[model samples]
Target: MKKILVIEDEEFVRENILELLDSEGLEVFGAENGRIGVDLAQQQQPDLILCDVMMPELDGYGVLTTLRQDSILATIPFIFLTAKAAKVDFRQGMELGADDYLTKPFTRAELLGAIASRLKKQEAVQEHYNTEIQQAKDRLSYLAHHDSLTELPNRLSLQELFKQVQPQDDNYQEVLAVLFVGLDRFSKINDNLGSDFGDSLLKAVAIRLKACVDDQDIVARINADQFTVILAKRNHKKDAADVAQSILTSISKIFVVAAQEVFITASIGLAFYRRDSIELQQLLSYAKKAMLQAKQQGGNQYQFYTATFHIISVDYLNLETSLRHALEREELVVYYQPQVDLKTGKISGAEALLRWHHPQRGIIKPDKFIPIAEETGLIIPIGEWVLQAACKQTKIWQDAGFHCLRVAVNLSGRQFSQIDLSQKILQILRETGFHPQHIDLELTESMLVSNTEVAIRRLKTLKSLGMQIAVDDFGTGYSSLSYLQEFPFDILKIDRCFVRNITANPHNAAITEAIIQIAKTLELKLIAEGVETEAELNFVCRHNCDLMQGYLFSEPVPPQEFEKLLFSGKNLQFSPKQDHEAKVR
Candidate 1:
């Protein structure tokens, strides 16, 4: 039942209004003045309030204003009771927020009609308010679990979904795979175009990714340029690979963004939930690592997380931790391997090699730690250390009368891509008091394949500084003769893989011979690596190779040992006894 309050200075009028409302089936209360009426309304929380215009303590307008200030009572219906029927008096009450008004000659029918109409209007407004409140709550809930820009489920939402579909109390086991897709070189596009264009491109990519998945699978935007698809009940690695390849092919197509045609590719990594127990984060991490490996191998491909990858990931984490402190602890040392003059049979130069002496693991080979350093970006600082140490050592040897020996330092892809690479190298030379001509920077062929123009520019700048540039591990990368012509490379070092079994394998011998001819045709000096036997050395010599470096000459030795060898003033002559001892060491 609805409750009503009637406030009037005249006791007769108050009683009449209360009785009329009570007879109409409303629970009615009466007050002699506006102040008492407000108190009664607050305490009883009546559905409607009928107040008088003129009263002691508080008038009808004052009562309405006071009630409006209280949140709980603000919306209650208010009406005025007045003796005057003047238009001006009615206007005053209405302007003061009156819901309805009753004059001196008002009938019972008029009073009931005003009360019923005001209550109906209040009910409508309350319903609208409740609906709006509910809608706002729903919007907030969605925003919490989804990406605001893409409107796709975010990492938190993905985690919650995983929890729902995870293996439960039943004996049946379920298999799932998480495919982490990363757009290769998306940042370049983002930078070339404006952020608005980049945002639109991401939206388009999201649409394509969603369309590629099944209804049962979940696709989420896990990062800025990365998306993840959770393939529940599909445990097979091949199924995940097929999906990844489809995604790669779809994204590799042309996309029109902001009226400009753009082409992009993606690298994907898949981690499966077979019978093994793994947390969501660990699985995601594994997929991420595999994706990065795909990117490192030149993107536009897919990789699956294998047992070997997991072991490597753990080792990578541990090695990254140790490498970060290697410089500070002085555990990194430079060893020099002689680059011999195969023609003159004299020591021509040395290559600076980095070796790590772990306190717990003894000496760690570069083959094991160098890749980890490169992946973790520890190579930047570590490469800088090698450059400085090599330059300083060369200057030391030059001062000690070994002026003919130049030192070569291998630059990783990350180091070679630095914007200030040439400047950094020049600064190191200046600080070490070494001539630029005596320091050679060896870069891999793969480094030049990604950004040929930028690589050419940087190489030109380094060449202009009087430093020699050599392509290390040649024939192992996807570079053709055209790249050799375009790049400002002074030497080409044949990869050790080809030279290791050149005599035993005719295929290896043919490739070596072809590489030597190509080097000669380009008029670029050739250096044969891993010449461990006399037959390999004689074959390289027969091909007129410019230099040879391997165990046949000398194993890489510490600075002190290298200095002793330099002081001997003797060229390395191949000896079976010395080669055996070097291999053992």
Candidate 2:
């Protein structure tokens, strides 16, 4: 039952209010003075507090302030009942956090209505606080057992749950199934949205995922944008696959938040657990490796751990070990892909792409080891290196007579969240002696969507440095077109998928045209990526595309080769082979 505490020194008025509330189906607790009222409040933690501001022993302000100091009672709504009618008195009561103020000789209806409003407000406030507290607790609990971002069971949670399903000493036959789910564009979300909003979207995704699973199954957020599910001991691979599909389906559904709808997808990696020799971390590693393989094959899919995949994983582990050394050894090279002015066919700028020159592996692709770096937080250092390296190269290019050419470096959304990224970039540019206008930072759509405010602020700061900002993979994102104007971007790189079919597919052509038109309207440069054919090039050029980059112009070539191409002046070497070959670049 709802309870109300009434504190008034006047016997007649205090009793009258108590009787009125009592008759109105509420439990009324009366106190003769403010001191006793505060004591009763701490003890009862009543639904509401009604106190006369001018009471003896302790004034209403004193009682309210005292209770407000205690976190437990701070939120309990307080109403002031006083004979003082001056605006100053009312102002004082409000400043004390009084929910409402009732002057002396108030009507029963007016008093009752004020009391009712305070009670309702209190109820609403409590509900909101409870939800926030519960969310915080859940977040902490999730962090304890799972990856805070992915809402996947953490290493600890996995170990605890894995042990529960481990076959006993007597039974070697029992097997436990585990599936690791990874999002293809989860980092994109973080890269586009600031980390907080990225975390919010992830938490929301986690809730959806949890709702899709069975009560008996153990699912936890394990790693960044990775979910680990411990299926029942006897659950079949097909069953796990079905659940994974359900998870993908659920997350794929448009999530309408803050008046906008967003969509996301995940890739699953599955492995069975054996108590004989396999450890928790080993199983998890295997699962994640398999998931990476699945993502490599193309996301929105699943892969089961197999001996063949393990062989690849072993190689990848070796690569990861070598990657750290490669950074220290300065074996990581930056390749530049030229962006050409579509109308004049002039070399406008270049995107600085990273390549690992592994001593044993020859050349390593970004897709092969980038995820590992991101997962292990090596991306922070690698990204810093990329930024500084790109700036250094831009300075070198300027010294070598390419002064006007801009060098665009991709910034991982994670790098932007470091609180000083803008400053860091500016410092790098200053230290490297690169002209700020000759550098561009390519951020993905996900970074802008995840945290609009932070991303905007960071980008704005970067823009203030006179560096251009471009949104990479523009078409394939969750950001709304309405927010397009708010972000500090100078260019939009149309995703290759959209550009790939534009030549042959009318629908794709229309979408690409619309994108170009939007860019034109915004007075932003439009770069059509992944163009593989003359027909595609012609289509883009016909639309007056500002820039174009793909194999058609040049695959991301080494700096030496790129420089040679510049010296040799081979402007356009693109020759469309066949209509059938007109696929993804």
- The candidate that wins on TM-score is 1
| Whole-structure CA lDDT of model 2 | 0.77
Number of backbone clashes in candidate 1: 0
Best by lDDT: 1
In candidate 2, residue 231 scores what lDDT?
Answer: 73
Q: Can you write out model 1's per-residue Cα lDDT over 1-585, one digit (the tens) per residue?
A: 999888888988888887777788899888888888889988999998888888888888889888989878987989887787899988877776788888876898888888889999999998876665444334434544677558888876788888876666556455688888999989998898877788899999999998887888888888789988888765555777788888998999999988899999999888876433357777888888888889989999998876676434676778889888999999999999888886557778999999999999999999888888887888999999999999898888899888878999999989988998888988888899999887778998768866888889899999999989999987655435566778988999988878885888775676677677656757898999888877788778778888988887788999998887778754645445433111111
Off-target runs (Cα >4 Å) in candidate 2 are 1-312, 572-585
Per residue, candidate 2 scores C-alpha lDDT tens digits across 243-312 of 8788878888887765666677778887876631267677777888878888988888888887676435
What TM-score would you give candidate 2 relative to the actual structure?
Answer: 0.49
lDDT at 415, model 1? 94
lDDT of 1 at 446: 64
lDDT of each: 0.82, 0.77
